[model samples]
Target chain A: MDKLPVNHMQLDRLVLDWMAEVRTYILKEIQRPIIVNTKSNMRDLVTNLDQNVEKIYIEKIKQYDPNAQILSEEGFGDEITDLTGPVWIIDPIDGTMNFIKQRDEYASMLAYFYDGQAQGAWIMDVVKNEIVHGGPFQKVWLNQNLMEPPVERSLEQSLLSFSGIHLLYDHFQYQTMARAALGYRVYGSAGISFIRLLKGQLGGFTSVLKPWDFAAGLILCQALGLQVKTLDGQTVNVLSSNVILAAQSLVATDIKMLTNTSSNL
Target chain B: MDKLPVNHMQLDRLVLDWMAEVRTYILKEIQRPIIVNTKSNMRDLVTNLDQNVEKIYIEKIKQYDPNAQILSEEGFGDEITDLTGPVWIIDPIDGTMNFIKQRDEYASMLAYFYDGQAQGAWIMDVVKNEIVHGGPFQKVWLNQNLMEPPVERSLEQSLLSFSGIHLLYDHFQYQTMARAALGYRVYGSAGISFIRLLKGQLGGFTSVLKPWDFAAGLILCQALGLQVKTLDGQTVNVLSSNVILAAQSLVATDIKMLTNTSSNL
Candidate 1:
């Protein structure tokens, strides 16, 4: 393991304090007029609120750990190629489109890694004013309460969250998987999707996601003994964008079996 | 016009007070165990709370208007083929699956029609504790404040609410319609979809709906200058199940053009 200036508990406390401040700023800022700009396309969006939140997190991280490497959605963080030392990943606002349009169902996320392994993670449901946070060093929590492990159920009896684009275009046999499940929901936010999974409201979720979008959620899901894998049933890389799947082990097995059979034909 | 025992304002006050009682009952009942059962299939659920709420509305309606007819989801109200006299439509819990599993995004809706014309309507977003109510007799209101008309935008610049079953099965050229919008969301409840449309968060919604499901929303949408029609661009009959499309006039025109072109091809 890489050596760090502060211990895991100390780093965790610092992150919690920053999140509280960030949440207050977001709630206040949304009441005022916001400036929005498109990123890769009209469907993809970024807002001034996203940038300001990212800047707040980066400044605080730099002050506490001057040498900490950072990877983030906005360009304010470092250009990171490796996760060899103490690293922090930030998604200032995980669902920017939802933030700009609906003003709800968005989240702020942060994950800490040491020697390419997760040390701690935090995800805040900004509108609801609650956070689900923890990692390997400490058990997971929803705000001040301890989070219990989600109950596992069969795919035939659970609600699955599949990408709306994939369902419409029939990519990766998503339509077949959806038919096998009890029902389908599309929330348009990965952070909110993970929150539902952690609460056992959803059996599984599959979507194309970036590193910052999945980093904090991946850590929280793993700590709860949920399976985190690529679409082809392989482990997920912490630094690259891929089609990610997170669910209970049984549900994952069922999804893979159903999708593979349809693809074979 | 058919004569009635009471005027529109008196009936509206009675429904509003009943909704407040129903909200308190549901919030408290959910804290305890709920009895859930299948209606049409495993995916179509009805709970004890749903039945109880429907009974509450039925009793109150009968007490207030002794000869009033009711069309309801849970079979607690009267059955009539014609809409000649005073008729009340009630959907005790609009999204029963969401209520049983997610504990949010469901609603209780009621509409009053006399001589086949809407007098008033009310939909309560139970969790949020806010109600959107109004009709031809009066303008729309969100809680205590009057609602402003939603801004009209073209299909390419707006978000849409669509049924997941239709998207997965490729019914009615839904995939084409979804592609034309800024994005797609599926919340699984017509009442919630209507609330989003009323708030201008969604530009349009399309789904297969029963009378109780669309009655309240249709009245409120029409009061706000939205177009409510069948998939083929015909006016909706307020008494039967149909594939309904509710949207701003510009977005509706674009959706109809896109779907018509694809179906012809």
Candidate 2:
């Protein structure tokens, strides 16, 4: 060890430990009765719990690394209009509606960007306490253990999850896409829904999602060595919302089938 | 008492006990490692688990209620060429791909229809073991307890789930509907995915699902006081695929958004 500068192993441990703290806080918050409040409709929701959880994370980050810049959903952190230096991109609670109602299909997403590129991303399944996480050069982990490769599900054998609108509107010819694939589903929660893509359950799905909605998952997919791209197969811009996003390689093969089917509709 | 009807209290208990047994058998199958086989494109999938689970339920139903007919996905049961009598519509695994791949979003669904009208429905979250079920009456249950009334999760405030293809292709104008809802989620499992709708966690949803797919959920939603209809807000054909399905009083509100926001394409 003559040329060792800093211990990379220790840094990894610290990140894992920090993630544990985040998980605990989230679980505690969930255990408490959710105080749901609607934003625009009974469906557009923002619970006090969502705000509280973000506040807790902000406080924790300040103590652990005051120098780290933050971008949060609830506007509880510093203005991070730019992704520079060691920036923490946090969603605090990804599926607010699920958090308020069903208590499942919710996630806590966090991503780190260093020098404007993703360094690591973690998406915690709050109900299960398992994390779909990725770092540079690593297979995704469900909870510290490497997950098995996504099941080799085929389009006819595959099951997909995406917005109901995507299919009903055939905005990207998804209805035709459905005919080529095995099956389809719609959940209202985006952050928590795409686990199938990362795990290789869904062939592919399309969504009009914002940066906060896609950021952590996008990074996690990249880390897992899966293709994460716009529906047109272009790179995702963290600053701009993609018209569509999908799981890579296998799912993409069905695009022709999708387009062919939807055009007639 | 002047007259007595064969102790309904006892009959209810007997039915509950029978359901409990079915639930246990279902759980055993769900827990077992699935046997995934491929077809179509890389996105399609099928599993030995789906066939096995369906077989177990059909056998049990025969042993318990031998004369009842069944409409099932797997060929283990008789072909449901028509819906003329008391038929048990069963989807052994609603989210087969999820079962084979994600192991999370799949569900075991059962519905009984008498003369093309629902008598009872059961939608069980196999992964979580929570069954949100009931029928005929305007009430639903999870396990032993009566479920709380559905919160007013409106389309704008609600999280809606649908097949992503529908929206992408503008099939029945799903994209506009989604823009009106709180958000969207696409899961691979239909029987399992619709649990929220019955429980009142979701405002509503729609998909091109077969009778077995919507049978149980339709009954359960009716009991929960929701409006279930085709995508065009028409009373759906119970024996065929329904283009849309969702809550009752909210139907007009939901459909208006879809039709208004929809483009001719």
Candidate 3:
């Protein structure tokens, strides 16, 4: 594959513009009824809107950079056995179940990375018409104006969003822990819940999410100066599944310890 | 206490007006910084806004009925060990953790019943500024417009919302039954989740919630034409704490089967 020579700025701008296009596709498809397919029992799902949304972006990406590698949920992208070179990791719709069911909490997520380094990312909440974006500028934006990191608070005093399954199945000892607040919450939308984390509503959050799910969210959190990593405190593999993501450096520390008991860090 | 004639029409208007007032209160409070206090370890919360919001409604109720009984979360209402006449059940901030942290997904809930006969109920979604009122109408408004129930899918084809500690800890074997869906979901708020159930996003829902937490929602579901009852297939109690609630009528059969093995149901 031949490499393109656009700097991060040009690429970021194109990605932002591309996000708007994807948002249009999302809104159009969302109002109509969706076709749902099961992936793993009822816990996993694939919607027609997911495929339609991803294909729309991939077609446009090909027009923008014919040589660009695409990692998409719909299998329209590259072979992508590994993450290498200018790959556009697209979830199109990060919270598919929420999209298929509620149509409100779901988000359209897009992440662009070069040589495994995320150059820019976006999580567009379609119903709300807000795209949370982040890049080298170290800012998160709804559109134009920048967003601040969440209100400073401790996990013990803040609301936490965790996959109730993980909290139950993972044996994190969270059940016995003193951290459960009266406000302990769960949104079930990784992107929307992550946005809430950045907005200062949740002190921290944890969930078994996919790469396309966390890609845009990671950039948004990093831009807001919060800590994010896999449950084991390892750098997230943008190609894998079952990753747990969180906010607040403090909350991340406790989460890392709880989820990965072997890690003394 | 002197028993006076119950004015159904007047109380309906009062319930509607009081709900509107609390909706405004929620909007104003959302903008202010939240002060979250920890309760029941760090997971449960009791925010200043929670208490304040409850206080406002308590005072209003007192003025309206003068002799009407009240049960509220913030200790601002009343105390009676038994079901009484024309009592008002209120959960000022039904999703307090969401209110304290997310500033969205929370509701100001109130249910009025005359000696246990359901009369009126309100669930005002704060951020959307939409009132899901069903006492007088068959339609549920998302904002200014009416909302149709989510596509009429079967339980196996729906997305669920049940995230109480009991789902995993107490071993909710019925998980296999609800898991028959396109996905299994959990939210932090029983009140908020039940309203979503009314939206038909989930084919059914089950949650262990308090009386105040579900009284208004129970009345709302009844008004919206959704099947709602305690998990045991009994009508809900307006005064006693309810351990389980499901919106779909079919769910009643399966969930009851799951809990029948244990006397817990």
Model number with the top lDDT: 1
Q: Rank the candidates by DockQ, best first.
A: 1, 3, 2
Please report, in order, the local distance difference test score of every candidate based on alpha carbons: 0.89, 0.68, 0.70
lDDT of 1 by residue, A117-217 (tens): 88899999999887999887678889888898888899998888877777778787788888999888988889999988988889899998889999998
lDDT of 3 by residue, A15-107 (tens): 778877777777776677778887866567788878888888898888987878988876778877765777787887877767766777878
TM-score of each: 0.95, 0.76, 0.85
What's the CA error at residue A51 for candidate 2, in Å? Answer: 3.2
lDDT by residue (A1-265, candidate 2, tens digit) is 5133223345445556666777777677667777777665555577776787677767766776678788777778787667766677778777676777677778777776776867667777777776777665444676767876564545666656665545555567655566666667665556666665776756665688767677877777777656677877677878667865566566666664466555677
- Model 1, B1-265: lDDT tens per residue? 4264446666667778999999999999999999999978788889999999999999998998888999999998877798998999999999888898789889999998888888899999999887999887668989888898898989988889988787778788888888889888988889999999888888899999999999999999999999889989888888899899999999999998888788789
DockQ, in order, for the candidates? Answer: 0.67, 0.35, 0.41
lDDT of 1 at B1: 46
Model 3: docking quality category: acceptable
Interface RMSD of each: 1.0, 4.3, 3.6
Return the candidate ranking by lDDT, descending. 1, 3, 2
lDDT over C-alpha atoms for residue A247 of model 3: 73
**Alpha carbon deviation, residue B119, candidate 3 (Å):** 1.6
